[model samples]
Target: MPSPCSSPRLLRHGPIFFAAFLSFFVSLGTLPAKAVEPDEVLQDQALEARARHISEGLRCLVCQNQSIEDSAAPLAKDLRLLVRERLKAGDTDQQIEDFVVARYGEFVLLKPRFEPHTLILWFATPVVFIVALLIVVLAYRRRSAAAQLPPLSKAEERRLKRLLEDR
Candidate 1:
């Protein structure tokens, strides 16, 4: 008798089982990890929505790449609570944001405002891309020019013919 691992039934169903397992993990990755706890949520729905919006635009200081809404860090939780508190205090979104910026510096904002200080951050990628594109064009032009061998002189053509005959 064959072992269970080598059974024809298992073999037939293995790929289907593997695909379902893979898809389950893939779906999990697509789901957002909301870190807001029950106590942090505001009683007012509109205020809660506004707070969530503000939180999404604020960066998590501990997880610099993730927004506060998506981050699970303690600091992110604090920021979320702060946003809700400000909302309860009847602060406009701008005021709440300004308050946070004043407290945490501009680094806490997920999207930094375009200003003289951040000009390089906004323009560097395009400037570097333009420079790289120019370099590639220049290199390609040089390679094309180099490959064209200026119509090898008559004497050089004769020398090539002689070498080929000798070979």
Candidate 2:
């Protein structure tokens, strides 16, 4: 007998199932649309590209976590405009980034700069992992040591035997 999973009814709908699955994955593969407006775009391709590249690294202050390139926030729009104005003035990418950082502090950067204050942020995960590994190793060793001890004292063994006989 054929299994229910291999029934003609299910097989008839196989193409529909496959089409739905393919369309779902194709939609997922598409990138999220940017929120940049038409008027906001720079006239110069090179300057626009640089502006976009810089904007991608900037955090949207209002949105908290979204990059300026992706955010719909008013602050993100302003930041995008500011990046364009800086590009128009012939600022280098480093200079533009420094200007934004000086005005907004490091929190406005999508990727924070490495500094003495951020040393803890950089090293915390490894320190935690090593500590957890040591704890796990110590626990396993203690458990193995306890498991290897002799089963019982002679008196305890005799007591257990007496209990078993009584039962």
Candidate 3:
């Protein structure tokens, strides 16, 4: 009897399947992995380092969760170039970051600044985590306490033994 694993469909399509698998990864490898192009790199090493540092903390508006430095989005590329330009113009890292925040709001920052509006965003995770931990600990304690039975009276023990014996 032929095993189900040795299907005629798989044998017939095997070469095409292998070719497709190889080509998929090859196409992916050909794609530009980083957002920053060669032309975008600053001539001054110090300025470039500062630009990279600032970009690393800025969120890519297109990618949403990825930092501008790590994202391949066109918006991320623009932001990276903007950072380098700002650095060349003698802007401090904080000033450049502030300028971005002013234009894009706090959402552009990977680690949002703690301000009146963003205070909740800054503290909500820790507060929720602590509350959940407390609830879990309390629930565990209640379950364990309920599981700990009180000492049985001699009469009750004798009755239980008799019930078991009868069964």
Pairing residues by index, what is the TM-score of model 3? 0.70
Candidate 1, pairs of clashing residues: none
Q: lDDT: which candidate is best?
A: 1
Prediction-by-prediction clash tally: 0, 0, 0
Q: What is the lDDT of residue 132 in candidate 3?
A: 100
lDDT of 1 by residue, 27-113 (tens): 999888888989999988999999999999999999998999999999999999999988998899999999999999999999989
List ranges where model 2 is wrong by over 4 Å: 1-31, 160-167
Regions of candidate 3 where Cα sits further than 4 Å from its true position: 1-33, 151-167
Off-target runs (Cα >4 Å) in candidate 1 are 1-24, 157-167
lDDT of 1 at 162: 100
TM-score for predicted model 2 compared with the true structure:
0.76
Give the TM-score of each candidate.
0.77, 0.76, 0.70
Native-referenced Cα lDDT, model 2: 0.91
Whole-structure CA lDDT of model 3: 0.89
Which pairs of residues collide in candidate 3?
none
Report clash pairs, candidate 2: none
